[model samples]
Target: MIVGIDLGTTNSAIGIWRDGTAQLVPNALGDLLTPSAVAIDDGGAVIVGMTARERQSTHPTSTVTAFKRWMGTRQTVTLAGKTFTAEDLSAIVLSSLKADAEAFLGEPVTSAVITVPAYFNDRQRKATRRAGELAGLTVERLINEPTAAALAYGIQDRSEKEPFLVFDLGGGTFDVSIVEIFDGVIEVRASAGDNRLGGEDFNDTIIEVARPRIDPEGRLAEVDPLVLHELLRAAAERCRRTLSEQEEASFTITSGDRQFATTVTAGEFEAQAAPLLAKLRDPVLRSLRDSDIRVETLSEVILVGGATRMPIVRKTITRMFGRFPNAAVHPDHAVALGAAVQGGLKSRDADLEEIRLTDVCPFTLGVDNSAPDGRGGFRHGLFSPIIERNTPIPASRVSYYSTLSDNQRNVEFGIYQGEAREVQGNVKLGSIKVPVPPAPAGHVHVECRFSYDTSGLLEVDISVPASGLVRNLVLMDDDEAPNAKEVEARRKVLAALKRHPREDSHNMAVLARAARCYESFIGERRDMVGKWTAQFEAALDGQDPRVIDSARAQFEDALNQLEGDRYL
Candidate 1:
């Protein structure tokens, strides 16, 4: 069976096409959403989701989160004396979701359609596919996140021909997609985004504001950087959420008999987040301009992703568009649901037979060429476009060029993808060395053809008509994608790690929440939390479901009263 998975930065979810509609699959904790966190327990067993997230404060050294930002890079983190690449961490999360899906379906599911940010370059895309492979699942396709959201929205309301903009701001990446839906087709006209911009940056902003006020001397960070950062992060997250609902909230962090707190108003927070919010404008305008759709002509501006819940974000978008956006789809669930829709379409489900979806190549694909510098000289690094950004997929385009020097026997093509006018500013996917017939300067003409399929693969073909020679190549970043042998070796190492029992997920989650609360509170409240956690531990030790359940409910209620409800 095929399932759809949203391998998100802050959280991940899985869904499937069951019965007549798409439905989300719940994890062992019976929750549809799972936090994208990985940790090694004291017993060296891997724990994920809520439990792992809670331990971030107490066990900051061995836990890692938000590794998605480094997906295609060479970043690595060491957990429990073992070093893991971004791909390795991602594979673990995907494996957890795969197991959850199998349990929910009562069958083994091996194939999936995964979603990635539209702005992810070729290397990032390849890295995502590799992560899926390491998880032991066949990745059927990689759908753009905003495009997937548009598909889910389009399917729900297909009554009219409407042009809309999807503003997707997730935890670690931001994307803007201009979409149009007519008849049975959902077409994404354009997409633009910043892979490094997202909600977590806002959290960092809060941390910066609170840190100086909390520890004026800056001694806390010096003692233990990891724990200090985690505590401040947790407090900042709470304050950010509280300010979303109210006008002001207290950002507090307690350590070693001392509690540091500061009151931050919503207005102040918005002002502080101004710089990050401003980065959102360029991508939105770029997408609209590329799609040739005026802002006034857009029927609806749909908001997706957890970050859009911020009041400042919504207000900024409103001011930009001169109208309120539609929030019809659940911010946290839209991508995964849309992925399930794609899965259904891949499976050719009877109910969605007539529905057609189209996406674009989000970046320009071209090769390097020398252009006249307008001074009778040549500029060696100019970029010539074969296929421009936002062009419909399953596309092929060709551009012709001539040899730069006399008696040139070969032309080297440096394939790149970007919006820059110069190749130096773009990403070099790889290069192809093609032989050409010897000739005078600009005598022998060479043809460069670029073909991009619906599944996001690129093939470049270079032909020299004079010699009837043609060379074709598939783009591959040697450093990003490892060979089959390397993949199998990494997969085996991951498979050897023990996993925490699914049946104990509830107790683990409760303990995790209590631990976070313990770190956040001080004095009398802290004592109460310690007492409650001890009681819960004793109940768990009794091995009685009735007592453990009662203890869990009480502990949860206490935490809810102390910290209010978290956004997750």
Candidate 2:
């Protein structure tokens, strides 16, 4: 079965087409949501989902969370003495979700439709596809997250001629999209977002206020920074969640033998998160401006993502659109359901035969040119737009330019993305060098065509009309990463990873958690967990499934008797 996955920054979910509708596939925990976390225990067993998330507070040094923020970057996290890239952690999460889907469907899942932020740049989109490959999934498409939300909603609430505004604020990113659903087509007119802004930032706002009160002497700073930040982040996340309902939430700060109790009000949270909330306006306005959809004309304002449950977020969105946001679909499950719908469409399900989905480029794409400034001198390094922002894709646009110098044998065209007037201000995506016969400046004009496909990958073809010579290049910009080669190697590693005995996953997870519990506690508790951890490891190594299962059952009873579910 080809499934649809919402590989979110906070919690991931998967779905499949079942009985002419989308069905959410539950994880091993028998829940539709799985925490996006990865932790490796001292015993070398890898744990993902809820187990890994719980391990983060205890074994902060060996756990990774929110790695999606570094997907296209060169940053690496040191976990359990091994260095892992963001894609590596994402691959682990995707693999776990894949297993959950396979177990639920009772079949092999070889392909998937993954969703991404509409404003994700070329590198980020490439990184996402590579991550899916590393999870042994043939990624058929990368649907934009907001567009996916709309698709999920549109399937249920069929609007023939209304414009919909989608406000998506997830754990690590925010996206606003203006869509018009009409004539059997779902078209995204414009999309905008702050890639660095999201629920995590709001949590950090609480961290900024609570940290000093929690540890007034900065005593936690001298011991371990990772642990300190992890603790603070955990506390802030709880506080952020609590404020979503009640007017005030009680918080207790802990540092060694020091403790303090404080109450954080919703008003206080709104004050601290004001800047981030303010940032929510620009993208909405820009998207509406680009779509030419006035606020008065919007038929519905859709709110999405786990972060959108916060009162301030909803208030900000309502303030932007002058209407209460629609809560038709469950925020956390909508993207996955929409992705499942896309998967159904890909499989050509009879129910969705007339449904067509289209997306738009979120940013303007162009080549750098040093043309006449309209004064006496030339305006060097100016951005010349070939494909304007909000244009529908898969799209193709060509821009022609001539050589600058006398007898110039080659022309270097720098591809950039942004709405800036100058090349330096815009993001330089890649460059293409086209060779030409010796000619004077402006003599040999060449045609450079940019083709952006549905997956948001950009392909540039530079051709000289006279000689008809053409050169092509794929964007591989991460120098510190092997990029293409590393992805292939990791894909093979994922194949091996997926081959683990599925029946023993529970036992292995418990052993990994026991190791984590032992790592976190002290005195008698630590020794007890350490002993149970050893027993479980030995039982697993004995290679008999029933014996291992029996040992796990006994050890889990002992664990519950001692520490309850605190370490589970």
Candidate 3:
């Protein structure tokens, strides 16, 4: 069976085609959404989802959540006695979901259509694909999360023939997309986002406001750094939710003998959140500019993600486009639902078979070229966008260049992705070296072809036109790119560590509150909470899950603990 998965930063969900309808499959605890967390057990087994999250309140040091933000970097998390790459942590989460899907269907599930943020760069996308592989699932296509949400909304009526904007603000990222639906095709004209900004920033604002009140000596000096951080995060999230309706919210922090109270008005909250709100405007403006679609051309604006529930976000969006945004679908579940619909389309199990999705590239990809000497090599290292932004996916483009110097037996190409005029500032995906027979300067014809598939990853093929020599390349320009031996060693180390999903203290407190807010989290949630808590304590007893497993288990447990009805 083919399933659609939304591997979100804060929450994850899976859906499949079932009984002529798309059904979101609940995890072992009977929850539709699962926390993207892991934990390790005393028995040296990896635990994922709820169990990992429950332990976070006590085990902050071992658990690693929000690793998605470090997807393309060399960041590593250490637990027990081992270190794990972000890709490895993600794989555990993906594998856990795969197992749950298999259990639900009573059969093996091999293929899937996963959704990622529209703004994920090439490296991040590749890392996602690798995570899928580690989970034993073949990713048939990697659709943008916002695009999938649009498909779900657009296909619902089928008669709604108009252009709409999708504003997706998730826990860790924000994406804005301009789309037009005609006939049965859904075309994403342009997409833009701030990978670093999202609901989390709003929460940060709350902390900033409450910090002075809580600690007269300042947050870092008066309260325990860890406790202060967690409390601030909680306060911010609470403030963000409260501002949705009321004009004000109160924040209270208690750590040991220290206690303080602070009240933030809606206006104050908006002011603190202004910087982040401003960041959102850029993506919207960029998407509109790229699509060349005027504000009036938009039929409606759709808000996706839990963050959109904020009044400030809605107001800012309306003010920017002069239109009321659509809240027809629950922001939290829309993307997952859309993914399920896409999965149905892929499986040919839905009446919406006539619908088609055409997504676009969010950024440009190109090879760095030397500029005129007088320009101080202005374009020399600058990224010359090969595939301009908004270009359709699964698309390929080629550019030709010649050797710059005589007897240049080999040429080096520094490939980058971004719209920056200076290459040094842009992300260098990787570099490629092509060999050529001795030739006079400007004589060697080198063809550089870049292909971006549905997964959003870039494949570059460099060929010497005359010699007919070609080579396929993978981009890895980061300083941390490992040699074969290092890669193998790291893999072995990861494999040896016991896996358990567990959350840190910060998220544990957050989940505790989320559970209380959602009514559906009555039975299984209560039981899972207790069981996972015991499991976590047991792992701690022996310093078990032995590093890798413990770290993995902590993450998984955190995700599971946070899997209340609030998200779904």
Give the top-scoring candidate (lDDT).
1
Candidate 2 at residue 254, lDDT? 45
Candidate 1 is scored at a TM of 0.98
TM-score of 3: 0.82
- What TM-score, over all chains together, does every model reach? 0.98, 0.88, 0.82
When sorted by lDDT, best at the front, the candidate numbers are 1, 2, 3
In the predicted model 2, the residue pairs found to clash are: none
- Put down candidate 3 lDDT per residue, 125-227, tens digits, no spaces: 7777766765667878778888988987886777646778999998899998888888889989999998998777788888877777756765457545654
Cα TM-score of candidate 2: 0.88
Q: What are the lDDT figures for the candidates, one per model?
A: 0.90, 0.83, 0.74
Residue range 95-207, candidate 2, lDDT tens digits: 98998998988898989999998888777777888888888899999999999999998898565858888889999999999888898899898999988998899989987
Which segments of model 3 are wrong by more than 4 Å? Answer: 39-47, 54-57, 217-223, 350-352, 375-379, 436-440, 465-568
Give me the displacement of residue 100 in model 1, in angstroms. Answer: 1.1
> Best candidate per TM-score, number?
1
